[model samples]
Target: MNTKIIKLDINNKMYETITAKQGDTKSRFLLFNLLDGSIPFSLENRSVRVYAVKPDRTEVFNDLIITDAAKGYCILELTTQMLAVAGTVRLELMVIEEDKKLTSNIFYMDVKESINSEKAVVSTNEFTALMNGLAALSEYDIYKSNAKQVPGIKEEVSNLSSQLDNMITLKLLMDIDSTNYRINDFIMVDKITRLQNIYMANFLRNLRNGSPVTIACMGDSMTYGHDVNSEDKRSADTTPCDNGSRHSFTRASITYPESLQKYLNKIYKNNVTVINRGYSGDYVKKGMERWNKKHNANLTIIMYGTNDSRADYVPEEYRGNIDEYLKWYEQAIIREILWGKAVVIFTPPKLQSFGDLDVDTFANGLIQLCKKYNVPYIDTELFTINYNNINSDGVHFNGVGYEIFGMKSASVFVSENLLKPQYVKGGTKLLNRQTVDNFVVNGTYSYSATSGAYTPSELNNTGGSVLNLNPGSSITYSFYCEEDDMFVIPYIYTGADKIKISLDFGLKAPENSIDASIGKGATPLDNNKSSLEFTNSGTLLINKDEVFTNGVECLRIPTKGWHTLTLTNEHSQSTGGTLVINGIEFMNYDVFASYVNINKYYRQNYLKYTSHPILGDTASVSEIRIKPIDYLKLHPFYYLANTEYWRNPPLQLIITDYLKGSIIYTFTIGNNSDTTMFHGEKARLGAYTGGRTVSNITLDNDTREIVITFNSGLTNKSNLLLKLV
Candidate 1:
C-alpha cells in the first residue's frame, strides 16, 4: 500500500507535501497541515510525545484522533476545535499493523489548495494575513525556561497569541447575519474603546487605592475553551478550529473569564474589572506560576487540578507542589491586596475517570490543602457526576459549563463574604451572601449555636439555672419580655447523654399582643410576642436537661429558693404539663459504651472473641477509630479478612437509633469474604463472681455466644461481649 502526508487548508489549498510508498509505514511519520496560513495535524494516541528541535525540548500533550474515511486507512485528525490556536500544529502519528507489528507504508497528501467556496477562500486569506502580521511583530519568546526567576516574556506573548487565535476561531464559527454583522462590528469598536476607558479609570482607581485587583481563570483545555460545535455532524473531525490559526482554543470571546465579565456587568450593573489569566494545559504548578507573577487581586480563584493526575502528576508530588505554592500564594496575594490579605481560591471541577481510584486521590489532596491552609474552598468534586452539565469535553467545561462554573464560584465568594454585591434586598436571594450564619454579627460574637440567633440565659448557665436537678425529672421556665427582635433559645449541653430537655414557650393569651408556640426538638422559633411563657413538661434531671444560651443572654431562673417549680407555656408539643425526672443519680456500668473490634462483630453480652458472630457475618470497616478510646486494643484477635478473596470486609457497624442516638464501632474479623460454613456450637458469656466465676450463660449448638468474666473493682450492671465465631 502507498502512503502520503498531505497539508490541507480550510480553503482546500495545499502547502508542503510528502509522498511515500509501502516501505515508509514501518516507522511513525510526522505531518503538518497548513490551514489557511497555519499548519495543524492530528496525533493518533491518548498522548503524543513531541520534540521540537527549535526549542530543543520534548513536550507531551493529550492527542486528538482523526480518521481517513476517503480511504480504508485510519488517521489522526488534529483539527482546531476553537479559535485560540493559530499558526501550525506539529503532529506525529505512529501506525501499527494488525499483527501487532510496525507497518512500512507512510503517505503524505496535500489538500490545502482545494478551496471549494468563495467564503472559504476569503476566510483562508484573512487568517493568513493575521498569522503573517502576528509573526512580523514578535521575534522573541519569553516563556522559554522553567527557572526559579521570572523567565522572559515569551511565554506571556505565546499566551496572548493563543488567546488571539481562540478569538478568531470563535468569530469564524459565529453566525454573522448581515445586519447583525455590521452591528457587531460597530459594537466591537465601541467595546474596544470602552475597554481603554475602563482600563484607564481602573488604573487611576488602583493608583488612589495603592493596590490593583487581579482576577484569573485557570484550568485545563475546558477553562481555555476547547471544542463546542462541529461544522458537519458526520465530518468525523470534531476538533475545534480545525483548519485556522486565528481561530484557536484560547480565544477571549469564548473563554469563561471573558464571558463572566459580561455576566457580571449585567448582574452588578457596573463593569467589574477582570483579567483573563487562563492558559490551556495548566495544572496546579501552572496555577502557582500565574500567581507568582505578583498580580494584585482582591479575589483570585484557582481553577485547576483536573489535568494534574491525568497528566500523570502523582498526588503526593502534586500536593507538595501545591503546599509550597500555597504558602507563597497566600503571602503574595495578601501583599498584592490593598491590605495584606489572602486571596480567594477555588478548587477545579472533577475529571471523568476510567475508574474511581483516579479522581479519589486528587480530591482528597485538594481537601487536605484547603484545610491546612485555612483557605476557603468550593466543593467541585461532588459536581463531577453531572459533569456533562458544565463540560463539553469530559474534562473541559463548555460555554454552559463555564456559565455554571462562574455562577457557582461567584456564589461561593458571595457566601463567604469574600464578595459582596452593592445592594441586596431582604429575602433568600440577598441572604445567600453568608455561608454560615454570621451576617449581622461583625466578627464579634462567638456563634454559640446553629440558629443565627442567640439562646436565652434561663436554660443556659449564662446566669442562673432554671432547672437543675437529678434523674428522670423536668422543669419549666417563664418570662414576660416584650417581643421586638426575634427570640431564639438553644439548649446547651448540661452534661453528656445524662439529660434530655424540651423547651417550649407560649403567649399568655391570643389577644395578649403575641402568639407563642413550641417547636419540635431543637428547631429554632421566632418568638414574636409580648408576654410569653415557656414551660418544660418534665422534672429537671442531670444529663436530661439542656442549658440554654451559654454566653449571649442573662437568665432569671426561679431565685425564689429553687423549689422545683414548673411554669406552664399554656401551649406546646408533648404537653402533659407534668414535670417528671428521668436522670440516673450515679453513672451505671451497663450504660458504658465501648467499641471492641475492627472489621468484625462482637455480641453485646460476653465480650467474646471470634472471626465473626456465631450466627452470621455483618459488614466490613476499613479505616476507623473508636474515638475517645481505641478498639483494636480491646479486641486483639481480630484480623483483616481473607487475604485472597476480599469482599467488603465487615469493618464497622453503623448504629442508628431514633431515641438512643447513633454510634459506629469497628468490629473484628478473621477472614475476608471467603465463604466459610460452620456446623456446631458456640461459647457462653457470663459474669464473674467472687475471684473464680459465677453466672453460667449457655449457648445452644445453633446459638452464637461467648462467656467472659467481668473482673472489675467497680460494680457490674450489664456487660456486652461480642463473641465472634
Candidate 2:
C-alpha cells in the first residue's frame, strides 16, 4: 500500500481519550487512526503500538490489531480494558511506502480518572525540579553543606526566576538532559542562556497548548549528527563509535538533534515531540523521496547545501554556479508548502572557503528563495561569522558547537518575544516585495511613435488610472538605482495567449553602455554575465487581477547607475492588444546574514560603504552615514562597483497594523544627501491594498505623510502599501 501519516489523531477528530474507572472495571471503547489509508491498505505489513502512563505506578504498552482500513483512516479495535487506564495514552502509527518507513507524531489520549481525591497533591517548585535533575546529572552531584550546587547558579537562577512571569526558560533548559541524555551525553548548563526565539510564535503556541506539532530537519552529515568517524549512520546513531575512547563526547554519542529534543521537552513540559528524520550523508536531492512520502511536519528547518561544493555533489546541469543548489531547494520547498507544511530555511554558516564554493553567492540566493516562495528562514550565516574554531574539521561541529546551535535555535524561538505569537506563521505572512516603497515615478519620458510602435496611455481598471501600452509607440522609464539588483514590473496582460515584450535596459553613460540586444549579448565586464536585455512574457487577459505576477522581468543588473527599462511591444501580434501596467517593483533582495557579515568586515576594517543602500522593507538598518573612505583599510568586499550584493537599507520606516483605526504615518525623503528616498518623485501616497482599496486614506505631499483609515478593525499583522503610477 502507498500512504503516509497526516496527524496522529483518532477518528480524525479526537485522540485515544479513555477513563480509568474504579477497581478493575473498564470505561469506554474508541476507534484509532492507526496507519489510516485509502484503497484498504494490506494489514500484513502495518502495525500500531499504543502506550499508556497511569495515575498510579502502572503503565501499559501493546500492539493494536488493525481490523480494517479505508478512506484515509484505519480502525483500531480498542477494548474496554485498553481504555481502562486513567492517565495519558500515547499512540504511534507506522506505515511502509515504497520501501521507506514513515512515522507519525505521537497522538495523546487525554484520559481522566473516575476518582477525585479531596486531599491535595504536593506541588514542586519548577526550579526545584530543574535543580534536582542538574544535581543528579553533573559530576558535582552532591550538595556541599547539604548546601546547594553553587552560589552563583542559585543567585542567578533566583534573580532570573524572580523576574520571570513563568518558568518558560527553565522549562526549556530542563528537557535538555532529562529525557534523551545517555552516559556520554550531558547538559551544558552554562550554554543554556535565555536565547531570543523571536520568530517562533507557532512553536510557542503549540508548546503552550500542549498540541502536537512536528519539527522536521533535513540536511547532510552535520545534521545527521555524524561524529569524528562513523559518518554514514543516517539515523541518530550513537553506539558504533570507537571515538568514545578518544573523548567523553565524540561523534558516536552526540547530536544537536537530541539536544534540541531536550530543549523542546523542557519548554513544552515534555509535551512536544521532535521528529528527527535526518539522513546520513544525504544531499537535498537524495532526501527528496523520503521527505516527500514520510516527513510531515508543522515546521521544517532545512540545513543542507553544506555539501554542494563537494566534487560529487553538484548536479550536471547546475555546475559553474553556487545557486544551482537552490533549483533543487526551490522545488523541494514548493512541494513541502503544497503539502500543507510551513517551512523555515536556514543559510548555512560560513565554511572554510573551499574551492569555488563561494558562501556569499550561495547564501544570497537562498534568501531569494525565501522571498521567491514566501517562506521563513533563519540567517545563521550571519550569526556564525563572529565565532571561529567551532568546527571539528572544516565541516562538522563538535559537542560545544552543536550545543551552541541547539541553544541558539531555542533562543530564537523562546527568547524575548521571538515567538511573539504574531510572526509564528514565520515569514510566510511577509510580502516578498513591498510595492508602495519601491515605486519609481516617471510621468515624462521619451517615446518612439513609429509604425506599429507603442505609446504610453492610461486605462481604467478597478477605478484607477492604470498605465497601458498603446500600439504604434514605445515608452521609456528612467530611474536611479544605488546597486545592481532585480526589478519586477507589475502589469495586467490579456492578449491572445501571452504577451511578449522586447526589453532595453542599460546604463545612461556611454562608457557603461549595454547591448540592449535580444539576449543581453553586450557586456562591459568581460567575465561577469549581466542578464540585461530580454523578451519578457505574461498571461493573456484583457482585464485581469491587479497583481505583480505577469510583468516584465529584468533578472540581475551588472551596473549601478541611472538606468532605463524600455519595454516595447515587439511581438506586434500582441501590439494590437496592449498590456496594462501598474508600476515596477524593486525586489530589495539581500541575505540578512550575509549583509551583516559584509558590513562587519567593512566596519572592522574601517572601510567606508562606498555605495548606496538598496533600501526596502523587512531588512532595513537603523542607521545610515556617508563619509570619506579611509584608503588604507578598504575591505575588498565593500566595493559597490564590483560587489553584486549590498548591505544596507535607507533610513525609512512604515508601520502597518491590522486593526480598525486610523494611522498617520510620517516620512522624510530629502533629509540627507547620503541616501536616496524610495518612491523618488513617483510617490503615490495611499494604503496599498489596491489603487483605492481602503476608502479612507489621504496623502500630504507637502509633509510626505499619509493617513489611512479603515471601516473595520484590521488584523493584528497587516501590510500597508503605496504605489507609483
Candidate 3:
C-alpha cells in the first residue's frame, strides 16, 4: 500500500488538506509527522489526542498511536464515521503533557464519496468514554453555576448542555455491532502484512529475473562464524567485520555469509552476495546501530539475541528486562521494513555453558514481536537442538556447524518462494530505459594491476568525456530496470588495437573468466549462446574511426530489479591495450500500456490528495513528444506544492507516452519559500525517449509554472501526448 505521510508544523496555522475516500475504514491511514517549526516534536511521555469535526458538524475524538516517539510520528486509521460524509472535515491535534498542552492549528480532510453503500457508523470504546466524561463535566458545570448564581455561567452551561446532549445522541446512534468492519480497523495487522508482501514480491521478482540480490547476515559471534576454525576464534575486543570492511581471521570465506552465498548459488542460477555484518560481543542495540549505518541489502538475516541474553548484558534504558531488549529488536525489524527491505528474524541458537542467561525469554519475546509485525522468522534454537555437537565453545558455532546453519537458513527463502516470481494480478507495463555513465557515482571499479590505472582522468571521444580502463582493469555497475527483456548497449571507443569485449552478469573475480552458460534462465539475443557473454565468435567489430559508438548489444536482461553489469578489459598486462567506455544503456521493448490498470490500483489503495500519473498509455500512436508542462501534468503530485507535505519526496520520475516509449527524469528540489513554484530547477533526462528531446526549461514567474520548449516546433500539442505515469 502507498501510505500518505503528512508532515505538519504545530506552530504554523496554514491549513494543509489531505483526502480520503468515503467508507475507507482500514486501508487508508494518515501518518502524521508532528513538528515544531522545522524540528520534530518530542513525543516521549506525551499523549496525542485527535479531535475532528465532520462535514455535518458531528465531532469525534480519539487517541493516536505513536509509531516513532523520537521522530514525532503518529498514525490515525480512518474509521467509518470519520469518512462518512463526502465533504470537508476539520481536524486538530493536541499533544498533552502533565502541566501543559500543545495544540495544532486546524487542518482539513476532504473525503471523496465512494460507490459502496454507507453502513451505520460504529463507535469505539474510547469515543464512548470521551462522551460520557464530557457529559458529566457539563452537569458539574451547571451545578457550580446554579450554586454560585454567576450571571454568564448559566448561559455557558446551557450551551454546553445542548452540545453534550447532541454528542450523547450521536454516540448512542453509532453504538452498533462492529463485526462488519475489518480487523485492521482496530489494529495495524493488515498494514504490516501488505507492506511485507510488497517487499517480498519485489524481492522475489528480482531474484527470478536473475538480478543481483545482496543479503546481510547481522548478529553476534554466531553470525561472524566464530570458532569456525580454532585459530579464527575472536575475542571480546576484536574489531567487527561490516560488509567485508577489514580482513581478519573470522572474515574468511568459511563464514556463514559465504556458506549462504554458495548454497544459494548452487540452488538457484543467480548472483547472491551475502555480507557478514556480525560483530563479536554485539547485542541488539549495537546491531541496530550497525545496520542503520549501512543497510543496502535486499534481505537482512538478523540473529542478535544470544549476546543480549547474557546476564550482565543489560543497557540502562532497558532496565535489565528481557522484554525491553525485545522491544529494541522489534524497533530494528520495523526500521528494516521501513527501509524497503525483506527482513528475516532468527532466534539465537542454543547456548551450552552460558550461566544464568535468559535466552529463552529473549527468544520467545522475539517470536512474539515477529508475529505482531508479520515478519518471517526462524527458530534457530530448535534447529540447533536437532544438530549434534555443533558448538565449539558453548557460545560460537564451529566450521561444520556454521555451514549447516547457513544452508538451513536459505531453506526459508526457498520454501517461502521468496526467490521465485509471483503471479501478480496486473497487466504487464513497459518501463523507461535506464542508463549508466562511465562515472556512475555508485559503480565499483577494480584493477588487477593499479600501476597503469588513472584515478581522476577522462578520455575525450565522440560520445563525450569517458573513462579509460587499462589492461586487466574492470568496472562494474549495478542498476535497476523494470522489464526483463531489456537490451543492454555498451558504448565503447575501440582504439587501433583489437580490443576484446566480455559481458558478465555480475562482478567477476580476477581468476574467473567469463562463462556464456552462467545465465541459465536468461534469454540471449543469439540463438546458440547467452547474451551475457561476448566472444570473438559472436562479436560486433567496429572500425577505429567510429570513435565512440554503441559497441554491441551485449545482453538481454532476463528479469527486473537490481542487476550488475561488468565491463572488463579482456587483455593481459603484456598486451597493453586501453579500453575506453563511454556508457551503458538499457532499452525497453515496446508493448501496450498498462497505465489504466496501474491507475485503478493506485486509486483503490492510495489516498487521492493529488493525482500523480504513474504510467502512460501507448495504445496506437507511433510517436509522441512530451514537454516539461506535459511532465507536470503527468506528475502533479510532485510538481504541485502538496508534495512538500510528503515525508519523503520522490527521487526519480518515469513518464511514458503513446509513442510506446518513456523517459526517466531525475531531479532534486531544494527548499522553496513559495512551495508551489519550482524555479530554476533542472531535471536530467536519463533515458531514451525515441524521437523527442527536451532542450531547455523555463519557468514563468507570473504563473509560477514550468514552460518547456523543445528543439522541434510545438505546433501540435495533441500529437505531444504525455503519460500519467
Candidate with the greatest TM-score versus the true structure: 3
Backbone clash pairs in model 1 (N, Cα, C under 3 Å; residues 3+ apart or in different chains), count: 129
TM-score of each: 0.26, 0.29, 0.34
Q: What is the C-alpha RMSD of each candidate to the true structure, in Å?
A: 28.8, 29.3, 28.2
lDDT of each residue in 1-725, candidate 1, tens digit only: 11223444434423443322211211222222223333232223322211111111222222211232111112222211211122222333332323342222222332222233232211111121124232232111111133223243233333543443443221211222222332112112222223333443454344223343445554455455554452211111223321221223433225556555543432233335566555555565554444334343444555555556555543455543545344333333222231222434555565554664543455455554444334445555532232234445556655555554454343332111332222211111111112222121111112121222122333334432222222233332211122211222222323222322221111111121122222111111212121222333343222212322111121111111100112222223232332222111111111111111221233232222222233233322121112101223234332222353133233333222222333223333324223232222322223322221222222111111211222222121222333222
Candidate 2 residue 486 Cα shift, in angstroms, is: 37
Locate the minimum summed-lDDT window of 10 residues in model 3: 168-177
lDDT of 3 by residue, 522-595 (tens): 22132211224333323333321221122233454444433345556655343445565545555442211122
Question: lDDT tens digits, residues 1-725, model 2?
Answer: 11122323232433434333322221122333232321223445444444544444344443433333331233332333444545565654555444665555555555555464223232211122134332242212232222244344323323433333122111221111113423333222111211112224455466446677677666656666656644422334443321121112335345666666665554444654456555555566655644445344676677776665453655655543465577567656644543445667767655645554554566667886675544555666433332345566676666645654554454344322221211211011111111212212112222222222122332222243344555433333333344433333334343422333322222111112233221211111222322233334545432112221222223333334323344444445633545455444443223222322333334332222211133232332222222112211123222222233143222222333333322333332232223333332223344544211222333322221233343443323434332211
Better of 1 and 2 by lDDT: 2
Predictions in order: lDDT: 0.31, 0.39, 0.51
lDDT score for candidate 2 against the true structure: 0.39
| Candidate whose lDDT is highest | 3
Report the number of clashing residue pairs per model. 129, 33, 5
Model 1, residue 691: displacement in angstroms?
99
Sort all candidates by lDDT, best to worst. Answer: 3, 2, 1
